[model samples]
Target: MTRLTALLLLLIAIPLAAARPTIDAHLHHVNFLHDSDGLETLLDAMDAADIEAAVVLGLPVTKKWEEDAPREPRYYMGDEAPVYYYSAADPLLIAALDALPAAQQRRLYPFMSGFNPTDLNAVEHVRRMIEAYPNRWQGIGEILTRHDDLTALTDGETARANHPALIAVYRLAAQHDLPVLLHSNLTSKRERSFIYLSELEEALAAAPDTRFIWAHAGTSAEIHRHQGALPKLGETVEQLLKRYPNLYVDLSWTVLEPYLLDQEGRPDPDWVALVSRWPQRFVIGSDVVGRFGNLGNIMHSFEPFLAALPSAVADRVARKNVQALLPGQAAMPLDD
Candidate 1:
């Protein structure tokens, strides 16, 4: 190749190679069966995806495998067996995090997620977990409240964002300055409006001090599956962000489909504008639920939408925003 051509190619490759690394704000270390591919698998996936860090969560509940069942269920929804609260999830997560080397540990921000949100003792459970682990847990959840099918499938009283038990948990979270990742859907199947939004709003109002990451921005794959795309979701999210300073949106699986990207795979202008306006309040997560094989693809799927955003705003949503949510960690510039 000519010297001029080689020089041009080098200049182009430099920027691409140095592209900012992302922090996956949401990731699960185990599935409903409490199964995992281990921390090593996750680390390799992170390296491949150029992800600098991750907010790793544990599944709060477990799916029951019936002995009479024809085959073992791989997922929570794969069988009719009822799911129930499993407190051991947190310890497993603690064990995994503890097993990692200091460098690998630093890359993972472990959030405790194994308690019944309806039990008043849930507060004590969270407090005890924190006290027991002492400087181990970074945040509180991926708390499964108001989840569509999971709400019905879970073998207990329905879990809601405004549940009394969760209120106490929120207070504890506020006291520790820990962010809570909550999965509360805004609507149910066949509802034309955000029927369940009030439940979330009530919780937000009650815990003004706690940082609540609204998982999937109140969207869910099941809801979309039944009702198709939700209209004006962007506007609703914008309004919520305006109303609550402590509220943050989790841009994950379900929100990506119709809200962030159009059917043609183009970035939606409304979402771009909304996220650009409040970049600091938004963060991206894979929501990959204990799987790492496709982690790279899932993280990179946001590229088009992130690319559509202003460079600064895109950087915040991709990495800095989530890091800043951690207790003492500051969002350092990409160059640093």
Candidate 2:
């Protein structure tokens, strides 16, 4: 090749190589609790996807659904079917972490949650885990919100009640300098119900030091269908994101089809505009439930979303923003 052509090709390649981001902060390595070799599969997927690091989470088995028969204590006591419940200290999690490649191990940060948040002594439990593996685990949340049985553990007042114990957990997170990932959602005919934006504002005021992340952007499938109703909710979320330096949101579950497109099948500019405004406050999360079908779908879906954004903005939303929230950690390449 001519010298001029070679130089031009090199320049283009350099910019393209430097553009890829380096982290996915909202990964869930739950198979560690069940599959003996789950961490291998998790790491393989990361490597395949060119993901540099991921924030892992552990939860009791209550989140799992039984297909054929009863095996363990059912946490969803209502009309919902029985599902097994396990402790956060389940051996699988520790084993998976132990088995990971040292580089991949450095990339994994753990968080703790349970179906019955109140019964688990969340504060004490997370404190112990963080104390034991200070570098391996970083924060806690993804706490269940809808099930009545689990909600009862938080005193039957809904996840937003800020019950004494829940407050204590938040306080503990603050003391540890860790961010709390909340699973608050916007559901109901009214603009707010399960966990209102107002309630979150109050919580932030009460615990200014505690970093907060609204899992799923606080948007649900049902809420997304009523696009007209979201302006108020969006306004509230926008206000919170602007008002609190510690407040953040996750884009993991927020990209449901309805929210991404209108009835006519066109991209919704309003939604895109809202997300773009606070790119720094959002993080990439698959919320991968470990089921093969779910994992495959999430893996396929995120690419288009990434492709839609400007490279600089996507870099922050995909990884850099999360790295900033994680205290004491320098930003790393998403695909390193």
Candidate 3:
């Protein structure tokens, strides 16, 4: 083709490639301090980003603003203060959802994330939240288990995916037909192997009936900050997906740089192939914590990867799969 024709073709393809709608399957409505921009602000962000729906989660842990600190830290990692499990996170989210009308509420799927994953009472807490809200709580998690720095900073016994408490929680999720969105890192910041893989595997095997979305495919920003990337992640994820029929991968921002996108920001061929191989088992998420200003950028960053896949597969990852995992049949009124 001539240079002008190629340029013209590229111009035409850009619009088509960017046209996919999205559902953020792993968004956090409250930050570490249990603060948020409210549901209306999030709705505006979603509209601007072309996001049709979202799985809204609350941070179960909150950072303490110690009196000795120079100034109050707005984020968890701002200081050496220990984080504690904050059960009020759920009520805060519930208040936000209740403030909005039913139509606006449908756009957001709130998951119960306040209880300590290591506490046996966590199972009962999840049950109460679900029963109290009836159809309000769709799933359980963004549950912090085996996280990198966050784990060390949290002021409690470490939460593991396979903890007896979590196994019980997983059973509760299955009973309610709710998908659990879990954040268990595959490996630690220093170790290269899948040290925590078995913990996650145990959880999966313990409650085979429960559906789980492995956040960031078991990776974290802190892990990447230290190790750059997990070795053989695609192969490991594929292996897990093959083994667990209920397993679904959450392709959030942390996986974008080294796993899904190449150095040039183009989609990595291997990931595209894996996603195409099992289209229904994968979904994308913003993973934005308590802030919606960057929501559009976070969602749009996946466009290159989404465009690289077959249209049907791309659509599933971008929008359909997460919707299917949601508990209710509420009408998603996007245009409203």
Candidate 4:
């Protein structure tokens, strides 16, 4: 072809490539012993959906028993199964991904987890993971922040005093310029205040450059109970967003039946307005785990919520926003 024809073809192709939707920034891939195919299934779904990339988090479930304890935690044996926990850096995670083709590997981004942020070793572990796979991984998170755990941190009488370990991890994140995704939730039954907000604010203040992505929008309590009052939680989120430029929220695990139980059986407009104002500060996530039954239900529940969103706004929340946060990674196609 002549130079003129080549130039014309190049110009035409650029627009077509720019039209594709980028990727889903937050996707959970469970690698239970018996279910080795979970990651493959998730990748297939991403391909079918035209999702260019996905951040695959490793969540290992295990059982823990107190030292020399006569009886194990009673809750484990009941209707709710008890499983011990593991971090994202477990060897099994690398092993699982090693089997995939290089192209698929490039499409997946992994993040290390230190379930207990208070552990000193957790800090070192995360730092090493970032150093080892500087490009393949983007951040450290999916850190568990249970009510009991926070209570123990603040409790003077408890054996486990405030460790300052999470703070240390944040420091490392700040130094490395990586975002830290926290799993914070409302602890108390009362509606007056959220317990961990103060601690989180302090951490952000200490590490100004360190970004924090709050999973589930810092929602600890059931959403149904707060139905018409969804806006009530806005005050906290609004304050944090304004105060911390690096702070972000994820719209995941928000579509469960209990969380969507308003009189209209729809999400509150107040909540929508809050997010709309700062669409760049949020990302779409499925939080899918377990077999087809669980994954199917989660997908079913989230589709409508996503569809209900305004097209332009949804596009930003679903993909664009996340790409902006991680510039080193590939950017999403604008046209799509």
Question: What residue pairs clash in candidate 2, if any at all?
Answer: 21-334, 22-333, 22-334, 22-335, 23-334, 52-334, 110-137
lDDT score of model 3?
0.86
Clashing pairs in 4: 19-336, 62-83, 62-84, 63-84, 186-220
lDDT of each: 0.86, 0.59, 0.86, 0.57
Number of residue pairs clashing in candidate 3, backbone atoms closer than 3 angstroms, sequence gap of 3 or more or interchain: 0
Over 1-336, each residue of candidate 3 has an lDDT whose tens digit, in order, gives 422223324444354225468999989987888788878999998887678899999999999999999999988889999999999888888988998989999999889999999898999999888878887788999899999889999987899999999999999898888899999999998999999999999999999989999999999888887878788999999999989998999998888877887765668999999999998888988888888887776677788889999888888889988887887533233322
- Give the distance in Å from residue 119's predicted Cα in candidate 3 to where it truly belongs: 0.7
The Cα RMSD in angstroms, rounded to one decimal, for candidate 4 relative to the true structure is 11.1
Tens digits of lDDT, candidate 4, 1-336: 522233324434342222335455556565332233466776776654456676666653344444655765333232232344455434556666777898888777666663455566667877677666665556666665643433332312221112377778878876776677676664433444555567667766777777777777666434323432334466677788999987888766552233332333466565667777776777766565433223323333344344556776668776677766663543344445
- For model 2, state the Cα shift of residue 291 in Å: 3.0
Summed backbone clashes in each candidate are 0, 7, 0, 5
How would you encode candidate 2's per-residue C-alpha lDDT over 1-336 as one tens digit per residue?
Answer: 522223324433332223344465566665422432266677666665556677777655443444653553233443345344455543445667787667767777766664345443756766776676665546776665543344443333355625455677778888877888876655543444544555566667778888887776666544544543355555666777888877887766444344544444344566567767766777767666453223333433444455566676677776687777776654454343
Model 4 lDDT at residue 83 = 48
lDDT of 1 at 44: 93
lDDT of 1 by residue, 1-336 (tens): 522233324434343224457899999989889899999899998987789999999999999989998899898888788899999999989888888899899999999999999998999999999989988888999999878888888998899999999999998998998999999998887797998999999999999989999999998888887888888888999899999999999998678886887766679898999998887899998888777987766677777789999888888899889988988765455444
After best superposition, candidate 3 residue 242: deviation in angstroms? 0.9
Please give the distance, in angstroms, between residue 78's alpha carbon in candidate 4 and its true position after superposition. 4.9
Ranked candidates (TM-score, high to low): 1, 3, 2, 4
